[model samples]
Target: MISIATALLCTLVIRSVVSVRGDEECDASAAYSSSGGKICASERGDGYGSHDVIRGEDRMIPIWWNYDIDQLFEDHFDCGQIIYGYDDGHPDDDHDDDYVDGLDDQAVKEQHIKISDPVSETELEKLRYQWEILREKYVREVNIVPIFHEVKLDSATETTGVDGKGGFVDRPRTHGVSAIVVPTRIGDAGPTKGRGVFATAPITKGALVINLDNGSTGLFKVGHSWREFAVSLPREVACNFIEWSWVQTVPPSSVIDEDIRNGLSIFIAFDESNLMNSADWDDVEANVRCGFPPKHEGDDWGPCRFHYHATRDIAAGEELLLNYGDFEEISQQGWVDIGL
Candidate 1:
């Protein structure tokens, strides 16, 4: 039997030789143990033997690192496939199908996969920031303006006539009439006297008069005697009369009246008793006659007054003529002009 001391020395020598050989001859037939016995080659067992030192660099890596690498490859490189065990026969060989199956099996065995909890605060904040950016990029805001038209009557005509009794009249009269009156003078200075009247002649039967606000264009009735025209409010002075007031109301109505002999009759009305009492009829007449006051005040007439009369017999297609004063006065009159 070998002595204990000699056996110990031999063991040390064998260990040194194996270390120097590295892994080159681990499986070679010439490899020997300290006793000069051939080293026995053992097949790697079901991954649980003491003799099984993991074969490659994969074995040297931490389990977590290996798992991360596998996951990355699976998610980004492989087309839904997994690479499994490395081949001993061919170092470069890769096993796709088996690898994926192995990974799945390992995951199941270890219970490593599970649904995570709710999104963290950081993630939610990111989402909100993105939403605000989108809102600012697309949001918008706007103000709208309106349009109007002007109408005029031709003064160059022989139709002017005098009523046998007193006042002046126009010829070619019509049963129903409509007209727009403008101020005779317009400027930055005080009010002026020169006003003009535009008459829509040849009034048609069943014609309807339309009232519109400064913001909108008036719509005309079909087959109406007057040509459809746009009307605009005066630009210079604010006409409080045009402002819609709950106190000043007019019933929707129309009227047909004849000229009083040769004298033209015009009507005006007001809300305040004192204002109407202070107005001058003669002044109103002079303005209408000579085209002085362009726009008439509602107070110009007491309660209600006929400011102008038709000069001639008005036909169905003729538009009635009136001074601007008449228009403002009537607005405040609040009487619905259902033709008498």
Candidate 2:
């Protein structure tokens, strides 16, 4: 489904060159046939120079949630102009300086030194000024997910058991509410085992572990119920959503009231939040609990909202676990269960 505009926008033209045989250049009529049907090839030369055309790969970069197609086009166009149009201003010794001798000296110099029209040095600076803003957004959106790692506690913490016998246990085991806890994983016998979040740093009780804000948690197929949306998608796509998404409850509000009854909204964690493993409700293994941000007087609740806070102090390198409750129940559906 890639369009012609996509191809043009993705390809960058670096330089132009022509292949020559000895002292004779290929005639215009034969040039197209000689270079494998490409008038401007990207291969360099042995006395026959060629264009350095480069095409960007069709890969995805994490972008802001609020960005649209128009904004992306504008930013890409501006960035391309700024990057490709830049020159070091070094003089070419191969060119003749006498060509400009009789011309308006100042006018020619100005023409040579000026940047591309509509994009001036001031505009570049202005774009540069937005670097911090973009960086902040990137940090909040991308880096908000904690690092996923696996750790074996080889160097166990030393402690005296009830009989006063020295024993090795997990180190620095602090027990209390934590202020923050990053979305982490642990190796345990659970439904969603093998995947876990490991803490690279110590997290205090009552600390914010990970905030799966609306921007990061993608609301997939906004339907009244999970079954309704899952049935509409293709088999594989529907299964993926069923496995990864949480049935989030969007309370009745002015912004959205369709889920007024028992129906809940479906959302998938576009980030690493989806990788978190669940713990049983009766177990003490669950250290973090999901919560929504406090609503202000006018603040509206969107279809997706979630954040995990540490229920107790979590030591560095400890694996984080959550009691999924009914949030993860939808994953129970299968090809036969959903009649796919």
Candidate 3:
């Protein structure tokens, strides 16, 4: 059930276009409505299931997760299911030995290869090769699919002190900001102890902020046992674009604070860690010094830079910020050190 407070928070944050039940024109000035039909100037809900109403399909935006090369292998094979190769009656098919013992040993080795430790690069490449073959064989049998959800805007206007309408008027080309409304701190917020939103302009009350690319939906499971997903940007260039757009939109008053300006810097930091961790470096370099090191100077760095939205306008007392860069790191570091 959605609380009245949550509903009001949503209305004030997103600056949704007010729709009269049967009216064609949206009334921007009309009092915000609740699920119960009560017209109130302030944000309120009946504490029923209105939370869903305030944050439902109308507000949901779609994002995609392009499977990483390794993820593709784990998804199809390591999920407790066999995805490749089949049993051949002749056990010594690939070896010169044709005896029963040799054939049995080959079968055992093949089973180990199928259900052993983490998939190796060679194994992943082989899987990809096999997948391609299977894909061709069952092009019509395979289905392309998408996961959908009604995620709340990560940077809501109330949270950022921006009016929704003002954002549209000022930055027509950019989407507004939204806040991460998760029950618990996740991503960079969990580790850094602080969280914020991203935008191209000063966000306005009632405007919508799309959690595009690395914003929120970038989460993915590592393995069956691990529930937390690392924070990451789709590409390094996309990170620069988000950072650049934010830096371009700041007001002179807020730009002088180094801490605020650098706050967005953590986005890059978390992304870097995500990139490293995703490669499964720990196991690969178990015995070699050439692999990723245990610790580095950049590891403990904090995000102190602040970047403003290009054309968005903000009000006073908003939490002024960006999304947490990575969740695993944030959860490990605790929330306090993230912003400072």
Candidate 4:
């Protein structure tokens, strides 16, 4: 086991490798923010507030944003497969042949995977401290997650964004409409002016409502940071990450940024998730829930995912109202840098 003294020493040394912020493409793990040259500074109020280490087995990470990836793909094609981050192995390494975790045909092969328990409370706290102070500089940015739907399209909607071919297009493009929730503006119905997410039909409780893909609908098992484009990101990206998101912390990704402890926040830069209104806790319209499959889930292990599920039987016309805590407005008391 690593000694505590050695670990503390390592933390300072890791932080010393900060990269000067610039408009150039960021390495994600090595890039630091401007001003004090930290990943994010609450004192400077970079819009990313409170590096408070709130720990949980599946704690929410309001960290970075990931969008504007169309340029990465050589061509825009049908990512026909269910959107998910492949683990260290084949894309389907996390599930068996009968089913690709929960994706019916998405898994590439069948295999047995070991099961691991969720991070224990004690272990979580220990990790929280180590990652926060000693973590490498990088913000796991989650700008958009594609919404994969099973229900049929009720309207004349078809795939938008890229040519529906292959490869990537860019941010703000669409894979199509999600069968899970529909975006319909409910003007001043209650306390919101944004579009409300409603059910396409009667959705069963406990159903897998979302898959959490960054360019698609919601963010998946990726850790991001505001590196290359912090100062130049689109306004939509700003609203999703810093303005209307519940940032969650990322555990050490052994496969990706093992040395970097990043936080992740997910929401569409331009979708209904950015507009889902808040409701009372006892009478929630929907719940922004996420889960991680066991070790058996391998590549499918969602370190963190943004999934909105129905808390109760919701009617078709009823707007999806999530309990955004005691006062959704109170969370933004110190919104001096919310530029979006």
RMSD of each: 46.0, 23.9, 23.7, 21.1
**TM-scores for every candidate against the unseen true structure:** 0.16, 0.34, 0.18, 0.34
Task: Return the lDDT, model 2, position 279.
Answer: 65
Off by over 4 Å in 2: 1-192, 221-239, 252-263, 292-305, 326-340
lDDT per residue for candidate 3 within 305-337, as digits (tens), equals 221121134443222333223222333232112
Q: In candidate 2, how many Å is residue 71 off?
A: 39
Two-way lDDT contest, 2 vs 4, winner: 2
Q: The CA-based lDDT of model 2 is what?
A: 0.37
Count of clashing pairs, candidate 1: 39
Q: Which stretches of candidate 4 lie over 4 Å from their true place?
A: 1-189, 213-230, 234-241, 244-246, 250-270, 281-306, 325-340
Model 2's C-alpha root-mean-square deviation from the true structure amounts to: 23.9
Question: What global local distance difference test value does model 3 have?
Answer: 0.24
> Which sequence of candidate numbers ranks them by lDDT, best first?
2, 4, 3, 1
lDDT of 4 by residue, 242-283 (tens): 333333444455657642224432232223354455665235
Better of 1 and 4 by lDDT: 4
Steric overlap count per candidate: 39, 20, 58, 34
lDDT tens string, model 1, 1-340? Answer: 1123322221111222231122434445543333333333332211111131222322321111111212212211221221111233332222233434566466653332221001223222322222222122112110111222222343546333223321335443211111222111111111121111223343222232221223122111111100000001111000111111111222222354332211111121111100111013223322221111223444233211222323234353322333334334444332221110
The positional error of residue 154 in candidate 2, measured at the CA in angstroms, is 37
Worst 10 residues of 3 by lDDT: 222-231
Of 3 and 4, the candidate ranking higher by lDDT? 4
Q: Write the per-residue lDDT of candidate 2 for residues 1-340, one digit (tens) a residue.
A: 1122332332232234443333444556533422122232212211112111212134221121112222222221212222222122321121124543555778765553342222344323322222222223223333323322222333354331111111222332222111223534332323224334577677876577766543344342222223333333332233334455555444444455543222344454434354455666335577766654234656542332356667678887777767776343445332222222
Models sorted by TM-score, best on top: 4, 2, 3, 1
